[model samples]
Target: MSPTIEAISAMPNGEKPTYLLVMLHGWGANYQDFVPFAKMLNFPGFGYFFPNAPFEHFQVPGGRAWYALEENEFTGLATSRKLLLNWLTSLEASTGVPLDRTVMAGFSQGGAMTLDVGLTLPLAAICSFSGYLHYQPEFQDNKTFPPTMIIHGQQDPVVPIEAAKKAQDELTKIGVSVQYQEFMMGHEVQDPAIALFKQFIQDNLNFN
Candidate 1:
């Protein structure tokens, strides 16, 4: 089955957005988890969309998961990728936001998905926090690599720091432009990450 997506848009009254930021959440979390972060960024005049994962998590109540994880491997990554691609197409069709003006951001598992999916799809930029590269083979064959930013905590237990390095190395090897930063926190997006995110969007998107 295809993943279900829910979008939360914030556009100031009388303002039409030239760019859109799509937020994806980590495993066992839904779109609502990103509400606080979205409001905190407060990117005035930009459209924000937070999409819920399709599947219900095994243990978490009312929680959704993009795909199942087995050990370090996301078991259904391929399926999730197809679902997200279709979701992106649907969002564009419904909102009329061009793909070139769309950016993707996520945390942890969601971050991994953003990197994996964003690289293959045409996008303006991608920001990942506390996420790593999964399904490297898929990325190796992909031709389009959007401007990418990856931020991770040095002490992240859920996704190791080394994973972030490996992702950076792989993307670099494949000639994907990447800006990576390490923070002092763990498995969470901090203020520094937010600052980077804002700058990344401003640099890549014509939102001013």
Candidate 2:
């Protein structure tokens, strides 16, 4: 059986949802980190899921991490990737929303995972907020990558802005439609990014 990561879900008060948005939080942050986005980026008929990372942070108390960053190496990326992939692939059965109607997004470390496993799945769209790529995915003729938005802060220090630029070039090489953006900020998502996020999600997902 595939492991199911714990998650927090939010939905508009209505009937069954037509689309799903899965938000992945950054390192040292729990699933609750992005829960507010569900309300702040309210979309009718769209349900949101924020899944907790599989491991507890080794240092930061009350924090969670998808994988450990230790000794300048990614210690548990493979495990986190597998768990996230399994959880995401199982979403349709649990939510009654298929992968084609779902969008995956993340921030910082979470953003890296978004590009990692997300590209492998048949999602409707993907948004990487202040996110970077871990490594370039090998080209696969059978895999169809969804349209993607890679947005970053020009002044970002946590994950440098170059990460986003590098990601753009790498993804483009693989034939992925990329919507790239840069903001005059640092290490976080602001109003401008949120605005683009709203527009991007609207353009990509099907709503009832």
Candidate 3:
């Protein structure tokens, strides 16, 4: 059985949802942290689900993480990916939203999860902000990958810009359509990235 996960969600205009936008929060943060960010996304006719990672109770009180970075990074990634997959499977069954219509996005470690988990799944699109790619043999053969956007800050101290660039390069090499953008700031989201993000979603996520 999959581990129990908690999430916060919002629908456009308080009506039924047509599309799924799953946004993962950074490490040491909780689900409620992204509620305002979701509002800023402003995707019409889409329901947003901000799932708190199972590994909460860390760093700050009530902060969560997808995996333990201090331990074996590879093993942690694999374990967290499994949890994300199971949660997504359950979500599809309960909400009737196909994975193909879902957009997986994240920030920091959550962005890394977006790249790790989203690449393997048949989602509509994947957005990675300050994320990196971990090369796996299985990923080399994926043929049905979705369009992706990688946004990173040039001065990111946590996850370097090179890591995000590596992700972009790797995705492009596999024939997956990828867009990369770099801002002049640090490790957090800004207005320029948000505008580009909105445009990317508008162009890619076709709800028809």
Off by over 4 Å in 3: 135-142
**Candidate 2's residue-wise lDDT over 16-114, tens digit each?**
888899999988998999999988988888899999988888898978888776536777788888888888988889789999999999999889999
Candidate 1, residues 1-208: lDDT per residue as tens digits?
4455665666656477766788899988888888786578777766778888877887899887877874466666777788888888776776678888899988888998998888877899998899888766344554768899999999998999999999899888887899999999999988888987888888887554
In candidate 2 the C-alpha lDDT for residue 14 amounts to: 60
TM-score versus the correct structure, for each prediction: 0.90, 0.94, 0.90
Greater lDDT among 1 and 2 belongs to: 2
How should the candidates be ordered by lDDT, best one leading? 2, 1, 3
Residue 162 shift from truth in candidate 3, angstroms: 1.2
Going through the candidates in the order shown, the clash numbers are 0, 0, 0
Question: Top model by lDDT, which number?
Answer: 2
What CA root-mean-square deviation does each model show from the true structure? 2.3, 2.0, 2.3
Q: Kindly provide the TM-score of model 2 when superposed on the true structure, using C-alpha atoms.
A: 0.94
Q: In candidate 1, residue 140 scores what lDDT?
A: 57
lDDT of each: 0.82, 0.87, 0.81
lDDT of 2: 0.87
Q: State the TM-score for model 3.
A: 0.90
Clashing pairs in 1: none
